[model samples]
Target: MPCPERHVIILGSTGSIGTQTIDIIERLNQRGYAFSVVGLAAGKNVERLAEQIKRYHPYAVCIGKETEGEILRQRFPKVRVFTGEKGLRELARLDEVDLIVNALVGAIGLPPTLDGLSLGRTVALANKESLVVGGELVTKFLSEYGGAILPIDSEHNAIFQCLRAGRLSEVRRVILTASGGPFLRVHKEELDRVRPEEALCHPNWAMGSRVTIDSATMVNKGFEVIEAHFLFHLPYERISIIIHPDSVIHSFVEYHDGSLLAELASPDMRIPIQYALTYPKRVETGLPRLDLEKISRMEFETLDHEHFPAFATVLKAAKQGGTSPAVINAADEVLVERFLEGGIPFTGIASGLQTILSRWESAEANLKEISSDAGNQDEVILSTLLAADRWARKAARYLSF
Candidate 1:
């Protein structure tokens, strides 16, 4: 019997994860696993998207700008082209698309994720914001629509694997390993003077600019903690983070019996990407294998909450359990962009998040008396989160560090 071809739509096709996912799909095809790219979506990287379209010949594609969509349509007249967030949703709901690889960054990724899951399509998710900002909505979709979410992030993917060692009832706690970014040794006081280039210099991973800076601030790790909570159905207290500079051990799950099951791999995003694509059946990735014998040292440290205050602030919003996470995510996105543009100091990222979150909390407290319930209507939840996101971005712009 021939292998069944799995149809896939990749959001963020020009991104680091999206390109790597394409590479994995090609490799899988060569290895007897049938996978086809049916749709691709990208934001502002038309040149790379064009190359991918030329190679893959996707059935449909989406771009951020309408002008660029016109260019793509003229270039590839046969391919259906769509633009902006609506395009993302259209590509996600494409008929016969077996999987939606959501590698999109920021809250923009959330709506398409909800769309894919609502249609009962499997989603290989790299966008942590989907869970961070809309975990409740995503959870509702999964329960009602009978879809699956395969985590593509290293830590959550690792925990997803380790959880198979025992049942969820048998689990005690899950430990997420962090690489401590490029500034583990830098003093807290010196962080305000740090440059964007310096902050983006990750020691273990090659990721997009936003993610690299989030890792430096350890905000990315906090996002993972929230992601794991939703993915594994574990409470926030049961999920933990630790600094492991080696990036060798991805994550760990501890059983009630005190046994710890860990997923270890060399620091490669493609490894988790492949696992997500091929899940339950490991295939040859041709990527470099982890050789534990060569360098025999692995160090672990407790996360310094004092040094990386942004992580704690994010967690605080996550604990608030409403639109707070959306606010934090949106504010961070704006603040990080400002930092990268040299408009704010490195420490401004954390300070700015603090200001926005504090304002959100105060506003929410005041509105609690008159706030009407929105119930669980998906559209209402989406609109509410989008409102919070817009408000945060606006607030972050006017914020002074």
Candidate 2:
């Protein structure tokens, strides 16, 4: 019997996760899985986007700028092209798309996620910001529209697989493992002097600049904790993070009966990416297998809050709920950029987050009386979060360390 084709639209198509998704799709197709790239979207990477379009020949595509979209249209006249943030949402809501692979970075990825779920499309999500910033809204959409989100992140993907071992009620707690990045052994007093080049050198995984820096500060791990809370419907207390320097065991699920289930694989994004695409049906990936014999040893350590102050700050905001997480995420995005540009010291990221979050909390307290009586609840929530996001970005830019 011939297999039905699964049509996929990949946002952030030129990014690390996005490119690996394309690789997995092509590999799947070769293995008798009918996976087709129906659409591709990228931000400001016209050269790479053009190459992907030429190779895969998606029916429609989207780019960050109108000028780039025009260039693409001239090159491939028959292919439909959409532009900007609105274009991303349009691509997500396309009727023919079976899977919406949101590999886009930062808060910009949240809206398309909501749009895709609004029509009940299954989202293969690599955008942690979507859950970190708008988790409540995302959960509401899932409940109301019956959409699904399959995590593409390594930690969450491992948890998703380990969760199959037992019922949700029977689970004791979920553990998210962190690689601790390049600063694991650095003394707290010296973090302020560490250069951006030092933080970017992640030992385990190849990722984007922002994410790599986040890993160094352990802010990425904090984001994962928030993501896990939403993905597993677990309380903040039930989700714990352990510093596993080896990056061997992605995550662990503990059962009430004192048994632990873990998903182990090599540190490859392709493993999780492939799992998200062919969920409930495993297939050969043609990638190198995890050789535990060669690895020999794995070590785990407790997360030192003093060493990674950003992680602690992020979690505090997450606990505060409402627009707090959005503010912190937006602020961190700006701060990371500033640090990479040599404008701010490495320690400035955490201290800046603390300052901005305190200011946001103070300002939010003043606006407590304001009520959203006009629009839909979701609209009100989305607007509120976006407003906080904007405020944080502006605040972070002018903030002096």
In model 2, the Cα lDDT at residue 250 comes to: 98
The per-residue C-alpha lDDT of model 2 at residue 295 equals 89
Candidate 1, residues 1-401: lDDT per residue as tens digits?
Answer: 76799999999989999999998998889888888899999999999999999999899999999999999999999999999999999989889999999999999999999999999989999999999999999999999999999999999999999988799999999999999999999988899899999998999899999999999998898899899989999999999888999999999999999999999998899999999999888988698899989868999999999999999999999999899999999999999999999999998999899888999977764444433466656786787888788889999998986
Which regions of candidate 2 fall more than 4 Å away from where they truly are? 365-374
Against the hidden true structure, what lDDT does model 2 obtain? 0.93
lDDT of 2 by residue, 187-243 (tens): 888998999999999999989999999999889999999999999999999999999
- Highest lDDT against the true fold, candidate: 2
| Steric clashes per prediction | 0, 0
* Collision pairs in model 1: none
True lDDT of residue 235, candidate 1: 95
